[model samples]
Target: MGRKHLEEITLLRGLAIIGVVAIHSHPPPLSLGFLGLNKLYIEELSKFSVPLFIFISGLVLTFRYTGETIVYTDFLKRRFEKILIPYLAWSGIYLLYRYLYKSETFSLFAIAKKFLIGSAYFHLYYVFLILQFYLLFPLFLRLIQRFKNRKTALLSIAAALNLIFIAFYESTLLIPERLPRRIFIFWIFYFILGAVIGGDLKNNKRSAADKISYKLLIPLFAASLIYLLAPAGLPLGSKLDVFWLMKKTFFYAALFILLSYKLASESNFPTHNIALKPITSLGKYSLGIYLAHLIILEPLSTIILNRNLLFILTLSIAWFFTKTVSNLPYGHLLVGKINNSDT
Candidate 1:
């Protein structure tokens, strides 16, 4: 059976998924007067997609492992069975579609190699990275739980490692191929940070003050930093790597959780509102929406983005399709833990 329903958890999951979709949609510029400026803002904000998902996954993992000692092997197996397997399955399905529809040529041997090594394109990188994080989280968790004084030290190490990885890759240090050490370097920090925060929360009281510090100040600081530094036509190089982004994105994710909690606690953002209910409803099946929408967006962009009205119309159609598919049984297979019956 699932744990007690946390509206805050699901709502945040939904919000994070939509943030990801925004990244994918790469929506046309809003009329923010400065057209170029607005497009830049939307694009940068969309980059939060991966960071947001990682942050939430970290938070959830930490919450699960708190104070309870378990075998690392078992933990890894369970996580892989649930998340990695599904990712591989979906990746294969998408890969086949790409081969057939996009005229992307691939030998059978290459397909096997890409699948086994996770060297495919688009969001498959996240699938591979998450698996790496799951493998590393246990040892990382043990360290944080053992050495309470090492939080700042740990953060610095993560920062330094992030910088090293970025310098080499020109992107975040990812396992660009099937190299184990390189991949390990790329993803370990987020896993550790999540586990540390989870462990910390066990004794760390959440007073109003702590909430303000972590939830509000941290995100505001991150936003200010991004605004100051990230400008138009930025290539999102190593500076946007997992380690560097996590420091701020973790704050943003924490803020999202805190805000959602407070909002739910006070019934601030009510489902009673007619307009938001649809968005939230879509959010309910966000994983389904997420996994399926990419198949639509890539092709639609080639056609619809040429015209503003067509783009809007295409988005509406895509949203309708996503919502429809999410309502189906297959949708449950996408989000992992969510139960569609509740809706």
Candidate 2:
């Protein structure tokens, strides 16, 4: 049997990529307090993009390959071909850009170090972090299967471990000097949650919209907003400060995943609605857009000062670039997989 394609997942990808661009395109500080607040809101809200992507990775991987006997070598080979190649390609491009425009000098040692650690660019660290998950996926899969009957307990343990790790890191600052935030421990909970959801969906074949209530969405949104903004006013060392911004980000990531599944359950979501074509297209070409956006944004930022306009331009240009490349030979290596089906 073929894998079922979920339009909602694609929609979530589209939304997440937009959020990613928004994070990178947030306006520079201005003298106005309102503008500062807007910047803070954008930055805070968009922080969920990376986590959402991570969640989607776990969900899709587990949903597709749960029962199958995966060969570790084959899996790693596929991932390296699809993801790592593009990462290297883009990392080299960014490095060259820095050398030419920013006048950054690098020795052979430095270049190798940058590639090893994903320090070639600010955003590329995510690729490094995700690669670690891919490497450890077999162990994670084994553990998940072993504890399949106790999923709730497993998830609770994962969540607790994540929070404990965050608290320890916050207190000791013991993150690896080379990798920094690229560590997998900081992100395991989202991946585990996604894997559990994927398993549930696969085994039950139920609509997520039916499982998750719509009424809870508004409350989640309100709570997320309040949590995000509250820290700005609350004094340091408050409860909110315990996890810092991570608490709110975790809340928002889960809420966004629920929202995506709910919307995807709609009958006319992407297929029947013409207005959603652009967004679905964004989802289709998300990897390419993601890899190429910062390249486009760097130059565009100088010319276009408006944050909203800059985001639009970066997204539009990156989408077009990805679309054009996806039609060429071996383009998938550069952009990850492209869903060629019409929206």
Candidate 3:
């Protein structure tokens, strides 16, 4: 039910990880120029990165664990141990970094509240989002197993539910802006659709329709690019919103992954081709870099480093730091995986 090792997925992960970093690598205050364009394009490419990550997680988890009898408690325990420990460690690290380096102060109780909500820093919300998905993995598995035959309907329902939530949440029913973000309703569609894709793969049911979807992707991608390139000064009355972009992002990621699968099959390129080795390695350590790269950015922001050069340096340092730390004793507690042994 699992995908045999595929090099293209790793390459996609490498792209996604760099996209993530690029979103954060804004240039220093100056006039708009090539550096500004760099930031804009990188941000556009990265808009789908988080959703892609979530989709990948759903796809891989469903592919690997669909038929296994899930002991919910034990499964959650094992999964959370790998993820929550690193989340908590990094949360605390960021909290201290804020207090010591920025000369900010907060009460212990305040910090605890911030930690619970993943509000200790900007990027930590993804941790909570992923953790919530893990907490509900058992339900997800059951849904996928039972509804694999009706995947289109299942995915359609999820999309409808998400859109309904967006419609209401964006209007004045007073659900409170922050509540929806912390809940899973906003993202269920992507995750469920990912499971559908994975389940189909597990069932060995590739069809010509898959190729049709790939062909359909080119126009969809162009439309998305046009939307991004459009002027941004419109008022809130404009119908285009983040949710619209999100819907497009879902399909963009979906079609891209399908195309990648098709291409991966066609290419006879060695998985460890010299050009791909570093990217695959970076993908392997994406988690640690995602957690720690903000620290690297703080100093870089103050200095006059070229944004492109800074990005490369940060990627290298983050990968090196993660690799070295993950080899040390108790490293798994801090970084989610051990590097000294075969994982």
Higher-lDDT candidate among 1 and 2?
2
User: Which regions of candidate 3 are displaced past 4 Å?
Assistant: 1-7, 27-38, 168-179, 207-211, 231-270, 338-343
**For candidate 1, lDDT tens digit of each residue in 70-112?**
7888887777756665566677778888888877988989888
lDDT of 1 at 222: 65
**Backbone clashes in model 3, listed as residue pairs:** none
Cα displacement (angstroms), candidate 3, residue 331, comes to 1.7
| Residue pairs in candidate 2 whose N, alpha carbon or C atoms collide under 3 angstroms | none
Q: Across residues 1-343, which tens digit of lDDT does each residue of candidate 2 receive?
A: 3336656677778888998999889843443277766765676777778877887887777776778799999989977787899889888989999999899999999999899878898888888999998999888878878878888788889888887766666556455333436888888888887777776666664433355666878687778878776665444344343232265666777676667656665543754458877888898899899999998998999989888899899999999999999898988778877853211
Tens digit per residue, CA lDDT, model 3, 1-343: 4445444556556666787787777532233366655555555556666666676677666666666677888878877887788989999999889989998889989999878988787678778888898889888888887876677778779878877776666564456545666677787876786677666655566622253555576776676666664533334334333233344444555555555545554465454788777876777777888888888887776784677777888888888998888899988777767311011
Q: Which stretches of candidate 2 lie over 4 Å from their true place?
A: 1-3, 27-32, 172-180, 205-210, 233-245, 266-268, 339-343
Error of 1 at 59 (Å): 1.4
Q: What is the C-alpha lDDT of each candidate?
A: 0.55, 0.76, 0.68
What lDDT does candidate 2 reach at residue 111?
98
What ranking of all candidate models by lDDT puts the best one first? 2, 3, 1
Worst 10 residues of 2 by lDDT: 236-245
Ranking by TM-score: 2, 3, 1
Per-residue error for 268 in candidate 2, Å, reads 6.2
